[model samples]
Target: MTSHQLTAGICSRLNEPEHSDELLSSTPIVQILSVKRVGSTNGPNPIDRYRIIVSDGEHFLQSMLATQLNHFVDDGKINKNTICRLDKFTCNMVQEKRLLIVLAVTVLEQSTTKIGSPVGLQNPPGDAVASPATAQQTPAANALSTTSTAPAVSSSTTTTPAAVRGQGARSGRGPNIFPIEGLSPYQNNWTIRARVTNKSEIKTWSNQRGEGKLFNVTFMDESGEIRGTAFNMVADALYDKLEEGKVYFISKAKVNLAKKQFNNVANEYELGLEKNTEVEECRDSSNFPVVRYNFIDLAKLQDMAKDALCDVIAIVKEIGDATEFTSKFGKTSLKRELTVVDRSGFSVRLTLWAKNAEKFTHTDQPVVALKGVKVGDFGGRNLTMTSSSSLEVNPDIPESHALRGWFDAGGNSENFQSHTNAFSGGGAVAFNRAEMMSLEEVKVKELGGSDKTDYFSTKATVMHLKPENIAYPACPTQGCSKKVFDQHDGWRCEKCDRSFEKPEYRYASTTVTAGCASADPVSSRYMISMAVSDYSGQAWFQGFNDLGEVLFKRPANELVAIRDRDEAKFTKLVEDVTGQQFNFSCRAKQDTYNETTRTRYGVQKILPLDYAEEARHLMELLAAPWAQ
Candidate 1:
C-alpha cells in the first residue's frame, strides 16, 4: 500500500447520517474506485452529472459530483484507483439515502498513474456491484432490485398533506414509491405511485392470432412519465377504477419496452397490468405532477408535416353529422367531422372515429381537448384520433376554460381562417366523388348562386377547342406552378424566391361542350360559356394544368413545348379533340374580372365519358320534378 493510502474503512463512515456532515467539513481521503456518467431519463436537454464510487481502504460508498465539480471527472482528473480527498462537500438525504455531494475536490495522487487495487471491501456499495464503466448506484437508483410487494395499505387511508408528511417521518412504515425513470424489465419487484394523466377508451381487437380488449393509461410522477396498458380481463378489472388525474399505488405489473410509434411519453418502458397487479387509489396527489400537455397551437399545425402526432386544445366551432362508411375489408366504421378554432384565429377540422364518433354530441359549442391526436391531410389540415388517443369535451384545463370564456364573449362571431382544403362549393362534392347534375338543370338552378363554390359533373361533347392563347410558362420549382417573369439571366419567381435557368410549361384552355340535345339558344349557352351540344345543352368549360393534360392526352409541359415550337401544331392538336365526349367535374362560382361580375366555370377533373353511367344520369334527370 502507498504511504498516503487511506483505506475504504474511512469512506464507509460517511454513509452514516451522523458522520456525513462531520466528514464533509474535515475532508476524507479516499481512492476513486469507479467513475461513470449517469444516464439521464429526462426528456431532451439533460444535465451532465458524474457518479463516483470512492473507497477509504476499509470501506467504500457511492457519491455524485456536484455540477460545479463535474469538471474534475470530465477532465480525466478522476479515474479508477485514483487517490482523492473531498476538500469541500455536503451530505444530504436524497431518495431516503445519505448521498455525498462533492462540492469541491483535491487530488492527493494524480490519476496520470494507476495505483494498486481498491483497499476497502473488494465489493462496491449497495446490493449491486459496479464496474469502472458503471454509474454509481444509490438505493434509489437500485430500488428496482426490490422484488417484494410494497406493504399492504388500504386505499381509504388518509393521504392529506399533513398525513403524507407524517408517514415519511415514520421511517419504516412509509410507502416506498419507486421513481418512474428507475423502472425497467429487468426488475419486477417495485411499486410506482403516480397520477393518471390520461386514459384511453377501451378498444377491442380481433385477429388471426386471437381476440382481446385493452385500454391504456398515461401516468406521471415528479421524476418521469410512462404508459400502462391492461388487456382483456385485466382491462375489464381496472377500467372503472383508474380515473384520470387521480394518483394510485400500482405494483405487481409486467414492464416491457414501449412502442415508439404511438406513444409520446418520455420513458422507454411501459407497464402491463396482470391478474396479480395491485392498484390502490391515493387520495392525496398534491405531490404528483398534474396532467402535463405539450399542446400544439392551431396555427402552428400548418407548419407540421403530414402524419405528425400532437396534442391540441380548441373550441368546437362546427360539428358535422356522423357518417357511416364501409371499408374495402367490409368493416363498417363511423366518422364525424368537427371544425375547431383556437385563439390563433385559425380553425381546423378534427375527425373522430367509431365509438368516439357515435357518442359525440355537439352542444353549446363545447371546447374539446385531445391528446396524442394524429395529423392528417385529406384535402387540407385536419386531425384524426388514434387508438391510443384520448378526447375530452369541455375539459377543465386552463386552455379549455379560456376558450369557453372567449367564445361566449363574441369570439364565436369572429371571422376565422378555415384550414380545411375542401373546395369552396357548398356540397359541391360529397366525400371524394362529385355530385351528378345536368347542364340544363345546373343553369336553371343557379348552382353556384351561393358565396361558396359548387362542384358538379356532366357528360358533354367538345364543340371546338379554342386554339388561341393555350399555354403559359410556369415556375420550375416542384409543386409550384405560379407564372414566373423572364429575367435577363434567368426566369425569376417572386413567390418562390428562386431563379431558374429555364421555366417549366403548363396549359389553360377554354373548351366548348354541349350537354343539351334541344339546344335552346339562351339556356344552351347558359350552363357553358361557348357552344357544343350534349343530351341537354351547350356550355363553355375551362380546363387548366392537370385537367388540360387529360383532354390533350399528354403532359402540359410537353404540349407547351410542342406549341412553342409551332403554333400550327398546337392548333391542330386542339382541333383533333373536337366532338369528343367526356365527363367533367367542374367548379362554378361568380367572380369579378375587369370590374364586371360574371359566373365562371373551371374544370377540376376530366375523365373519359362512361356511356352507361351517362345514360343512367340522363334518365334520372328526365324523371325529375324539374323536367315535369
Candidate 2:
C-alpha cells in the first residue's frame, strides 16, 4: 500500500467530534497493525471481543472491532498491513485514552509491507494527572489498563468529544460512562452508573453438567436497561453488595448476547459477572431513575397471547391461601393466588410462586406493581410471576399512589369486571361466572370451528352416563399421572420406567381409554362421559377426575369396588346422578380422527347451583336496562 493511501494524523483527528461529518464524507483509510482478543471464552454465550491497533501511517491508536464485523478478522481478510476505509465508527474516551469503535468498514487493499513508521499517540508533557479521588472512583481505568498505573490526563488535555452526542460522557467517576443501551460485546474498558431495579435470590440447579448456584439483577439507567447475572462463588460475593433501588458504578463485566428466553430486559445484550467484575455503590444516586415500567391494563390481558410477559399495576382485592403441589418431576412448590383490580374497572388473578407466595402478608388492599409477569389462559386470563419477575407492594411511584387514593375514595366499592368471565353491555351475568351459552347458540356460532379453542359456561341437567371404561390405574408416583398397566407380577408405567406392586386409581379421559386396549387394567378411577340437556338442546360432555368427584360424591376407587361387590347398588348410584342440574364450565375444540371431524366439549369446572347468587345476578341484569 502506498504511503499516500493512508490518511496521516487521521487517528487523532477522528477523536474530535466537530470533524465527524468531514471525516465521514472523506472516508479516511487506515492500515491494521494488530488484533487481539479480550475476555474469557467460558460463559453461556461466550464473549468474542477484538482489540485492534490501527495506524493512519503517522499515529497508531487502539480500536475495537464491532461484533458485527468479526467475520473480517475470522476470515483473515483484515490482517496486519491490510488497508481499510472507516465507513462508520464512534470515538469513545476510556481512561484518558481514545478508543475507536468501528461499526462499518470497507476493505481497501492487502499487502505484506508496512506503509509508514507509526508511533503510538501520547498525551502532551506536563499535563496535570487525575486526582486521587477521581482515580479511586474509576475502577475500570485501573482494571482494564495494561500498565500498573494509568496516566489519567486532565479534562482539558485533549477534550475528546463523544461520537454520539449526549450518549457518552466522562462521569465524576473518571471512566467513560456508557449507556446501558450502548454496551455490547464489542466495547471494553467502560463503566455504567445504573440503579439496581430488582435482584433475585440465589438459586441452585443440578443438571448433567454439574450443580451450581446463580442469581440475576436488573439494572436501569435513563437510556435503557440490561440484566446482569453472577454465578456460583461470584453470586455469593456480589448478591449482598448490590442492593435493590441503589445506584452503582459497575465495570469489568463481560457482555454477551441476551438469552431472550431467560431475560425480559429490552436491551440486546446482557452482563455476566466474572471474578474480576467490580461493583461500587454510588452515593450520589439522586439523578438516577429508580425503576421504569410499561404497564398494561388488566382489561387488555384478555387479548394477550398465552405465556406472554407484561407489566401491570393494580390493587390486591383478594388473596388466596398458599397451596402446595408436587410438580411432575416430584419437586414440591408453593403457590398463592391473588385477585387484583385496577382503575380500568377490571380484575385479574395473579399467582405468586415459591418464596414470593410464602412471604406475602399484605391484607389492606395495597396497590401492587409487577414487571415481567407471564400471562396464562387456563380457565381464563391470569398472570403468573416467574423467577425473573419483580413484584412491589405499595410502591412509592406516582401510579401506585394514584391507585391507592382511587381505591380509598370510591373504587374499592365499585363493581369491577373480571378477566375470568366474559362481559356484555353494562351489567350481564353468566351461568357459572363465565359467559353463559346454550348448546344451540354454541353450535350456531361455530365456537369450535376456528383454530383456537372456545370456552363457555352453561346450566344443564345430566340425562345419561357411560358406565363402561370409566376409570384406569395410574402411576403411583406423586406427580406421575400416566396410565399404568398390570404386568401380572407388578404394575408398570412405561412413561415412568418403573414397576410397582399396585397402581393408584385416577379418573381416565376418553383419550386415555382408547389406549387401554393394549394393556391390562389394575385399579380404577373416575372418567365419566355423560349426555347433558338444557331447554335449548342436549350435548355430550367429558368430565375428568375432579369434575367426576363433584358429581358422583364418591371416589373412583370406591365406586369400582361397589360395582364389583353389588351390581344393583352400583347401578342405582349411577342412576341417582341423573336429572341433577349443575353449572358447567366447558372447553370446546375440534378433534379430527380417521378423516372424521367433530367438536369435543370437555368440562373444566363443575359448580353446584348457587340459587342466592343466581337470583342477585338476575336482579342486576333486570335493573341494568332501567338504569341505562
Candidate 3:
C-alpha cells in the first residue's frame, strides 16, 4: 500500500511570507498539486480565460466511484508518500488573479480542526495546539479570508488549466458546450471554473400566480459571457447564497437551447438554472477569463447621418417645446425634440419622448449617452430621432467628463450647428403669464410685416353674426384637412381610417363671432393654418352629404353675416376698453377645399367694423393693466 503525504506543493505562488516560513520550517508530507489542461492545446478561447479543477480528500470520497474520471484526469508530478516532509504548490485567484500558494506540509496543529475561519469556524487560542508534524499539513488556511489584501495580477493574463476539465469525461458523458464563444466543443457536461461575476438574489413572490421567486446572475469564465436565471424554487434555494465577482465550479446543467427573445438583459441568451443545475463556490478557483469592450466614439457620431446606429455622447444644447403630434402607432403621447452637439462640426436633433422629455426639461446637463442609437432624416435634411434604440443621459462614465469639457470650451460648433434660442426671442409662448400669450388671444387680430408693429390688444362682444353661423366637421386624417365624402355606410373617414378604424370628427370649432375681436393686429403666420382649415372645410362641404357632416357647415353667406355681426360687437368691446380710439382687426379667409397641393383660393382678409358710443352699455371686467 502507498503511504503518502496527501497535501503537497502549494505555497510559493502566494506573496504571503508567513506561509513560506511555516512551510520551510515544518515537515508534513503532501503531494504535487498543479492544475493543467486535460488534452489538446488550442489555447484558451479568446472570449473566456480558462477552466481548471483542483481536488483534495472531501471531493474524492464515496460517490464518484462508478464514473471513469480518467478522460479529464491528468496526473500531477509524482511525489513519494512521506511523514517527516512537507509539500507546496500554487493557484491564482480567479477574478483578481492574486497569487495564492497552498502549503501541504505537516503542522503542530491538527488538520481536522477548522482551516481558515471559513464561515462557521473561528481560530481557537491557548495551548491546545498540534505537534509540528501535524500542524504543517494545514494549507495556510489560517491566512485566508473573504476579502483579499494581496496584489492583483495584470489583466493581460486570463488563463485556464486542463487536467479535470476537457471536451469529454470518461463516464460516458457527452462533451459540454459552454455558451461562451469558442466553447462549443465542450457542449455536453464539461465543468467550467468561472467567477460569479455578477449575481442578483431571488425575489420571492406570493402573488396571484401562487408562490415563488425568480432570480438571475451573470457568470464570466475565461471564455466569454453567459447569464443564468433561477425561477421560483431555484431562486429561493440560491439567491441568498451567492455574491458578485466570485468564482465557482459549475456542472450538470441540461445545456438546453438559448433563446434570444427570452433574454431581456443586454446579454445574448437566457440560461435556465434548472433542477439538475449544479453550482459550487470554487474552493480552488485557480484560473478564469475576463471580458472587456472598446466602446465606440461619440464625437464622431455627431457628423454621422441620421438613422445611423452609432454611439454618441453630447450635452443637451437646447430643448424645444414638446408639441403634441399623433403618431402612426395610434396613441397620443408627449414628445419633445432637442438639438445636441458634440465637439464635431455638426449637430443632430434628439427626440425625447414622454418622461425622457420631461426629465430633460428639469435637467441641468441633459448630457446623454446613446449606445446604439439609430439616426434619422427629418424635416428634409435634418437629423430626426427614433425609439428603435435606447438612450442614457449622464451615465457614470469617463466620456461624460470629456464631453462636458468639449461643450464648455466651445467645441460643439466643431461637431454640431446649434440653432439660436428661438423661444428666447419671444417666439415661444411658454413664458410667464406676463410675457406669455395664447394663439387664441391674438387669434382674431392680424399683425404682420417687418415694419408693422402696432401691437394692440382688447376684448370684444357678440353683435350681428354673419350667415356663416352653421358648424361643420373636419377631416379626421392627421395632416389631411380635406373633408370626407360620406360613404353613407357610416361616417367613413378615409384618412384617419387608414391609420385607425375611425376618423376623428372635426369640431368646426371656430366661433362665428357675432362676438367682438381684439383691437391689435396679430401675426399673419397665426391665421395661415386657420384659413387653410376654413377653405378646406368648404371643399369638404362640396362632397359632403346630408348623411355625412362636412368640415364647415355654415354657408358662405352665413359666415359673412356673422362677420358683420361679430365685427360690430368687437368694436364695442374695444371701445369699452380704450374709450379714446378703438379699432379692431378681423380675420376671414377662403376655406380650403383641397389640402394636397397646399394651395388656397382666397386670402385671409381683414374686416373693419362700424360702431358708435352706444357700446358703453356693455358690462366689463376691471381693467388689469395698472389695477395693482
TM-score versus the correct structure, for each prediction: 0.47, 0.46, 0.29
Residue 217: error of model 3 in Å? 3.2
Q: Which ten residues in a row have the lowest lDDT in candidate 2?
A: 147-156
Q: Rank the candidates by TM-score, best first.
A: 1, 2, 3
lDDT of 3 by residue, 97-129 (tens): 222232232322223221221111112232133
* lDDT value, residue 315 of candidate 3: 74
Instruction: Tell me the spans in candidate 1 whose CA falls farther than 4 Å from its real position.
Output: 1-126, 131-174, 261-264, 286-288, 326-333, 420-628
Candidate 2 lDDT by residue in tens digits, 43-162:
212234556778888877767765546678778888888899987565655545445767568998887888778776553233224442343234333323221110011111111223
| C-alpha lDDT of all candidate models, in order | 0.62, 0.69, 0.36
User: Of 2 and 3, which scores higher on lDDT?
Assistant: 2
lDDT of 3: 0.36
Model 1 CA lDDT for position 385 = 85
Best by lDDT: 2
